[model samples]
Target chain A: MIYLDHNATTPVSPQVLQAMMPFFQERFGNASSFCRIGRIARTALEEARASVAACIHASPDEIVFTGSGTEADNLALRGVCRAFHGRKRHVVTSAIEHHAVLKTCEDLEEQGIAVTRLPVDCRGMVDPDQVKNSLTPHTVLISIMAANNETGVIQPIASISRIARSRGILFHTDAVQAFGKIPVSVDDLGIDLMTLSAHKIYGPKGIGALYVRKGSAMAPILTGGSHERGKRAGTENIAAIAGFAQAAELAEKHLAEEAVRLAALRDAFEKEVVQRIARARVNGRDAPRVPNTSSLSFASVDGESVLLHLDLKGICASTGSACATGSPEPSHVMRAMGLSPMDAQSTIRFSLGRDTSQGDLDFTVGVLADAISKLRHISSTA
Target chain B: MAKERGDRDDTGMSSAENEKAQPIQGPVLFYNDTVIDHFTNPRNVGEMEPGEANGYALVGDPACGDQMKLWIRVDSGRITDIRFKSFGCPGAIATSSMATCMARGKTLEEAAELTDDDVVRALGGIPEDKKHCSLLGIMALQKAIDDYLLGRMCAEEGDDLS
Candidate 1:
């Protein structure tokens, strides 16, 4: 099956699987122990940390491994908020952040911390000026995502960083969908804390990392024995961490070339969609976006129906449509982008990966032409 | 209309759709075979000509992302034919198709009594979250019956309603 839902998650690459196989079998030892086996585990863990750090231009000491991207986001928001309690009682973020950040901010609000959710534009980009305007004297953090998981619209991260840096507020970005698909440098963007998930970059699931800049006043969210230098607790996932390192290195190696390749494929695919289908349009067509995603909306057709038709034809894609993922509402990202509820439900997200080729996309466009034509014919609106 | 599968000549499904849906679909995800069959090969799947339909109704709100338009032709106080079109999910399409199948050839009084539960039960079962979708088609059919009754009264009163 052709997989165009890489934004949700990805399979572990063959290289990553091979690199992680040894740690699961012969090199199985807890990183905390200090004996010969443990020493080997510790060395491997640190090396993995260094590789993760190198991908984002951070030092090894600042890298703290977590269970998943959600954990890293929770760690950043809760850890920073809990550290500066009572003094800085407000946090600022965009409304279109992943639910990990959005829900954590909700919990922070429940604990009496004020949160200002900034609104994004119709293209799903959070205006840097609006973020600057939302900050109060008590605001201690500004968290925004580098790119949206649904629309793939890249936000104005460097500008937001300039604003947060001038205000002395710590900046955090959820880069789960941005890293490996695009260039993400902590120093280049001036990000204080960033979230990374290995699964999104073709590494194994259950491995994530948070980059905490040196001297950032962040307390540990998970409090236990001193793992991740007191930032996170629990025994390290050595095998997954090793796989994550290999994935990061591989992504960095092909980052530029794949970006060009995928952008060409996505653009050409969208061009054919406009030519062959009526009332079909790209959601973030004019916005600056990552190279691998296309959010297509077809008028007078349900996205779930299209997705099912594609699945039957051996093509795997996803949609923001309701009742498919058990959510009663369409995507919040679409709603925040000023899409009508009907338009929101009509959206289908196709995210390309390393394995996608022109032939696959060509076959997809042909099948898509048939699917949309059939559904529209069955619809009364047509 | 329930068990006479493959006998009706009006199922708008064609050979292309049958070939498209002929693959052995597993039940792990999405609907059962019955729902998928109706969705992929829906019966009475088109709309009626402008003046051919004596009764018509459109149900569901676009804000909810599920809508269905149904048309009915009545003859001598008996339902003769039914057709529908939907902008909805697989459950909406399948349930709409089944509702039309259940309504055709029944008397108007009998057709008006058709309920959402009957349509859903006939399909074995729909996913819990999608049970709401089954209501769209039945609601449309009931409203179409009302439209037919209303039009008959207007004609009887010598009021030429457009």
Candidate 2:
């Protein structure tokens, strides 16, 4: 089947799978043990840490592996907020953030921390100046995503990070969708903390990392053995980490070339779909989005029906977040972009990945146009 | 167990085409085979001319984004011809198709007595979330019968069903 939902998760690369196989079997010793086998595991773990750190231009000591990107996001927000719970209790974030960050901020508010959710433009981009103005003396952290998973609209992270730095506030970016698909440098962006997931970058699932720059103070959310330098607790998933390192290395090496290639494919698909389908338009058309995402809104057609039709044709796509599917709520991101409820429900997000090809794009556009017409035909008659 | 990362919990704000989901594999098992069959090949899917039908009704909930229109020809107080147009999910299409099929030759009173359960039973069973879809079809059919009776009682009932 043609898989165009890479933003949800990517298939693990063969290279990553090969790199991780040994850790799950022969090299099964815990990294913290004193035996020689344990030392081998420890060395491998540290090497993986360095590889992940290098992907984002960070130091090895700065990377803290976690169970998932959501956990990494939780650590960044909760950890930072807990550190300043008694002093500063204000946080700044964009309205279009993944639920990981948006919901975490809501939890923080329950603890008496005020949250300023900055709005995005119709193109789904957060203005850097708004980040600057939202800052207060009590603002301890400003968290924004590097790029939206749905719209793929790239945000001005460097500028936003600069604003947070000038005010002595911490900056965190959920770069799960951006890290592998685009170039992300913590040093260049002045990002104090960031979240990355391996599964999104063609690595093993269940392994993600939170990058905490040196000297950034934050408490740990998980309490257990003094693993991850006491910042996070739990025995590391060595196999997943090994695979994550391999994926990160490959992503960093081919980021520029793959981005250009995928952007071409995505743009071609968008152009054709819009041309062939009546009243169908691209979301975030003018924004500087990541190379792999195309969100389209077909007027007067229910996105769920279109998605079901696509699924029936051996195509997989989503109207909202994968988790939010089967739920009746409209996409919050589309609503935040000022789309009407009908328009929000009418959206479909197609994300390309390294595996996507021109043939796949052609097939998608052909099937998509057919589905839209079918749905619109039923709608107009009804 | 390996922590599955790629199965990202895209809670909100992100969207993907979900082919991996079991339900999308084939008519989501929440709907039975009959519902699937009818939804896949919905019957009587076109609108009838307003002048051709003796009674017509349109019912919709703007909040639910579901709407149904039913047209019925009352000859000798029996629904001789029936057609429906629906805009919603698979269940919406299936229920309306089933409703029209069930109402085709029934007397006006018999059609009016049809409930959401009758539609569900005819389609085997609908998913719980789709129970309302069956209700929509039944409500539209009942309203059409009511419209037919009201038009006969009025001296100046026009051809406009709206």
Q: How many residue pairs clash in each candidate?
A: 0, 9
Error of 2 at A295 (Å): 0.5
Model 1 off-target regions past 4 Å? A321-324, B1-29, B61-63, B154-162
CAPRI grade, predicted model 2: acceptable
On the 0 to 100 scale, the lDDT of residue A49 in model 1 is 96
For model 1 chain A, the run of ten residues with the poorest summed lDDT = A320-329
Q: Write the per-residue lDDT of candidate 1 for residues B9-82, one digit (tens) a residue.
A: 33333334322334233332358877888888888887788688899999985435798999999999888888
C-alpha DockQ of every model: 0.53, 0.26
* Candidate 1 A-chain TM-score: 0.98
lDDT of 2 by residue, B39-108 (tens): 6667767778878898889897565467788889999999999887777767777888878877888899
* Model 1 interface CAPRI class: medium
Clashing pairs in 2: A205-B5, A206-B3, A206-B4, A206-B5, A316-B17, A317-B16, A317-B17, A318-B16, A318-B17
What C-alpha lDDT, on a 0 to 100 scale, does residue A210 get in candidate 1?
96
Question: lDDT tens digits, residues A1-382, model 1?
Answer: 9888889889999999998998887899999998888988999999999999999999999999999999999999999998996688999999888899999999999999999999888888898889988999999999999998888999999999999999999999999999998899999999999999999899999999999999999999888999999999999999999999999999999999999999999999999998998888888788999999999989888888888899989998888522236565778888898987877777899999999999999999999889989888899767
Per-residue lDDT tens digits for candidate 2, residues A216-307, read 98999999999999999999889999999999999999999999899888888998998898888799999999999999988877777788
